[model samples]
Target: MEDMDAGRAGTARRWLDKLRGLIDPERMGDDFLYLLYHDALARRLGTCHDQRDNLYLRRFERPQIELFDLMAGHLPVLTLAGRIGGALLADHLAGRDTATLLSVGIGSGGQEAAVLTALAKRGRAPGRLTVIGVDPAVGSLHQAERAIRDTGVTLDFHHVPRFAERMTDQDWDLVRRAPRPLVMNAAFALHHLRDTASGADERNTFLSKLRDAEPDVVVLCEPDSDHHRVALPERFHNSWRHFHAVFRLIDVLDVSAADRNAMKLFFRREVVDIVGTADDEDRYERHEPAETWLARLREAGFRPMPAPAESVSEPMPPAFVRHDPDSVRIGFDGESILAVIHAVPAHA
Candidate 1:
């Protein structure tokens, strides 16, 4: 009886934790109350329901960032961008027998795998490949390592556990010493460098360093929303525009109701974090539009490398399924939600 009671008590505790996680104190009496309230009501009505457990903590918990794609049918824009960028770099460096790749915010290294796979398909897979991955999350680093290893490519990976802003000289030296014609992919990672104040200089400085490094090519994939604005009201409006479109996309997805609800709730946290947090909070989410990235790259002396005309006309797979297309298009689910940029230094 005692052992059985103990097990029951532990289960009850877990249940309590899950319930508590579902209720946000910030939304208890605000305009956002209706949002979570509707979710609660939906659960009670035996309709589609999201997981009650804390999902924000699981953002990068998996080895791959495909959960959002699985639940919401979001096309893998970054991976497609990576493939195109890789092909561009491979063609640019045709004389080189080996190539090195440096990825910022490599999150599970899925994008890098796509880049390598693209190179392989084109008979441009480097004789030897090296990847220098930088991310603040050690868990994410491990996941990236595992994902890269699964590809069975001749790629050497070195992970640096530091945010891009805090990277030391030694960290950069590793990238600089690698073989010439180094290529970089920074997929959905640059927005977090924003702060409460203007990040114009910081953004420029970050890109300037990359410019000085003189990598043959750098690929950047970022959200198309204007969530990086310092003002809360404007940020909320852009986020609303972005997420509302996302919700609509989720609603029509072929996924189950439970999956649909889970995706809604998962994205809700992003809206809350972007709106609720002060500018000084380091953990706040900040996303910027594609034009901002284009200007930044231009300021950093990078010139756009357009996809080949033939590749541009190639057909893309229907939504939800995973496939690499050469064209670097940003829209997803009939909405343009992200930007994929392939560029090289002005003088390179």
Candidate 2:
């Protein structure tokens, strides 16, 4: 047993050293190096599981769910993004007698619930509100249903257990036939839509479908990194820079070390997908920069809308927010971590 342990430790050390050598010293600062060292050490020591699998499939597992909630509650990027998304959705829903919200990848309905709660507080909730949640994970759909119902708001809830890219016409008919004043929200989602060499164009195709649905407003919150490149070296450099900032934010949280470590562990699956998936068709965490999404939205015939004022007015400590003419972005240490974009149909 001692010999086996030693062998494993040696292998782990060698892997870490190889990873360190790949990263350019000028590209990664000392703090990032320290964070990477600890992350690699923890995974090797079995403090965090290293097995790779479909990240969405594990969405409802108790451990992953708990870690997700921990990060959502304490991590400044997630907390602020959720808040900003909810605010943006609420802004569109204000003063409507009836409205429909079609949320893609509505995992656990946390952001939707917050939007409903905010509307209720402001006495601006629609008399008849319908929520349609689309996600491939059945467990996540169930959880979202429960969470939205628990919001104590009387509204219609519908679930389409299908990937946004795989939604059948019947499923879209449900969305198309839903009540008017429709507002679409995709938060930290859409990145999972796979793009292949065959040029399936799943992401853009889905966006075009959304545009055809003629939603009054569409809100998209996504990471501002470009991990979608097929080249390993470029993808690795981007992933390292993006996640370095994320780990830094996690380090400053007031949570216990155990919880913090677990939260970081949750991201390991993402990192693995970004760097380990040699086949671009099989990779799921294909995050792109804000500019890419903006261009896609425009190509899909959607016009970008100005970001809400509140999104950029107050700067959270260690997290700064800026608004371009079209999108609001949140970042840490000079890296743009996340972006929230609002858009409407070109004719609207």
Candidate 3:
């Protein structure tokens, strides 16, 4: 067992070193050249992740969630943010008899499952837990709906097979039919709203619509990076910093070469989107830092709520603590990468 573990670690290290060598901005010098090199490495390494395909999600995204859950208790910061976010949501819904949870980008329903578990444990199980999941991918929604239903949580789940930004009256009508107060939960999904040159405009518009809908609280768990910027140079630099930290984290994990490579490909797609696309329509994986989200939430008529009493920062795993945590923010490598932000409608 010990020898096998060492072998896995060594293989992971080599993969990390290779990826680092390819991603070294100083060595690459030119952003365009770096993009070209990155693309070639992706092809050669067989790490290309296409989001449009169902097979990709089943083969990569679904199994990745299992890995995420396993790492959550050990040290993974991204999954840690999710635990904190779910706790906050549970606290918000504690005393309510019935509340709606609108999970945007409910990929495979992991976050929803986590939130449901939290609520059940709190003894605040709503009389009717109406879960409305909105996603552009119908296949993902079906998987999420099934995943949550299998959890045996008594709830009415409505899947809106459409993009959250493009939600129409039919979707809203479904949401309206749910018992209130409504809670909007977005996990790693809102960043995809950057389908236009003005991501801020699109973000604000979506938040405005949500605000008008009067959700009691909005829980946001997203990557705290600045890859949402339109400028390729800035995007490249910011992405390098964010992904450098991720690769460093993956290097230490005792996993198979194939698993590590799949993760590499999954994240590499983000690099491709940021550096490869000039047109907004071609981009789908835009991410912004926590501060950007805070600003947008405020502009869209939401105010930050206090972190729950149970919310406490843990000793970050070695080499991953990048920024200091005050009350609500957690950083990795001086960048606030994972955050569990709780905000309520300003008027409420």
Candidate 4:
């Protein structure tokens, strides 16, 4: 019982620390490339993440809630899915116990690793989850590695040396030549592509190679917004609507003073402003589309994996003060939608 209590306390500290790190731009550096892009958008044009729009908050909070929901509420879903997929693929290709699984977007590592480790505890860990996290963001990976600790699972943290696009063809070639029977998982990282052109350039090509590598399972998880697998329209360049969605949640559900003005300050003063984009006149509305995402995923030879819904044991209390009753979500403006995609070697 004492051990369990200690574990809980440690988890709480980690969460608080991560949140502080996320809100603090300085610590993020290149490790949080996602946040970096958002921050750039805010600074480049002088756009603002206005928290007034209920729908905006809905979309903004959508990803956060999805991460929270899957990680916090629906643990078994990920466990079962990853375990089964990992096992099947590894067994078929890597010769039972010798296969290595890869996690593309490790994030803070807490969520996926927690689920995976829980599966491992049950003796269901697939072969050897090599658990390779690839990202240009060193900070997130470093934090994740420390947080995950030694769970008896083999975790290989690859700094990615550089962002995907910057990766040399030789590096991609090496990935292409990787062994069969591996699990490659990417989550919440797909929607960042500026356009199909961006994806087609390197990521799509690399994904095509992975398809050839015949990893038993390739999984992708992203916001369930109607945008999944779709191309984000040029409209996203207009403003930082996505970021503000969460801000509204903070103000409506959590903030004591309901300091709505701070929300505005962050958006207007802190958000990025893309010069050539629409909101660049103000730098605010430019939102990423979900359509191009679909086309790209398909192009990469992946199909959607329907994620089952599971309820939380003790769900976190909704941020009522920061919430807009009319608002639908903590991230976006409504209920969060998560899309997980799974793929296997064409032959297998």
Candidate 3 lDDT, 168-270, residue by residue in tens? 9878777766688898888778888864554446788888888877888888888878877546556767877777666556556677644554554456556
Model 2: pairs clashing at backbone N, Cα or C within 3 Å: none
lDDT of 4 at 167: 56
lDDT (CA) per prediction: 0.62, 0.76, 0.66, 0.43
Best first by TM-score, ranked: 2, 3, 1, 4
For lDDT, candidate 3 versus 4, the one ahead is 3
Candidate ranking (lDDT, best to worst): 2, 3, 1, 4
Give per-residue CA lDDT, model 4, range 1-348, as digits (tens).
Answer: 122124454554444335434553234322222343443433333444324332333433334434454333323323333433333333233324544445565667765555556656767554554445566688877877766555555555444545544556665555555444566766555444333433344456657766665667666555434322222232232232443344444444433332333333333322433322223223322223334445665677765333222212223434211111111122224533233345454454
Off by over 4 Å in 3: 1-37, 40-75, 195-200, 254-262, 278-280, 313-316, 319-327
Clashes found in each candidate (C-alpha, N, C closer than 3 A)? 0, 0, 3, 64
Q: Please identify which of the two predictions, 2 or 3, would achieve the higher lDDT against the true structure.
A: 2
TM-score of each: 0.71, 0.82, 0.75, 0.52
Give the residue spans of candidate 4 off by over 4 A: 1-96, 105-108, 138-149, 155-159, 173-180, 193-200, 223-288, 309-338, 344-348
Candidate 2 regions with alpha-carbon error over 4 angstroms: 1-62, 312-314
Question: Could you tell me which 10 consecutive residues in candidate 1 have the lowest summed lDDT?
Answer: 318-327
lDDT of 2 by residue, 324-347 (tens): 898888888888999999999988
Best TM-score goes to which candidate? 2
Per-candidate Cα RMSD to the true structure, in Å, reads 10.8, 7.1, 9.9, 15.1
Please write out the lDDT profile of model 1 over residues 1-348, one tens digit for every residue.
122124454554445345556666344422233354334323323344445323433432332345555642443343445445555655654435777878898777766665556656666667777878899999988888887666656767898998887778888888888886698878778887854254455677778888878898887777778876546546656776777665665566566655555555666556656654433354446787777787888888998766664433343433221122322555446666666677888875
Number of clashing pairs, model 3? 3
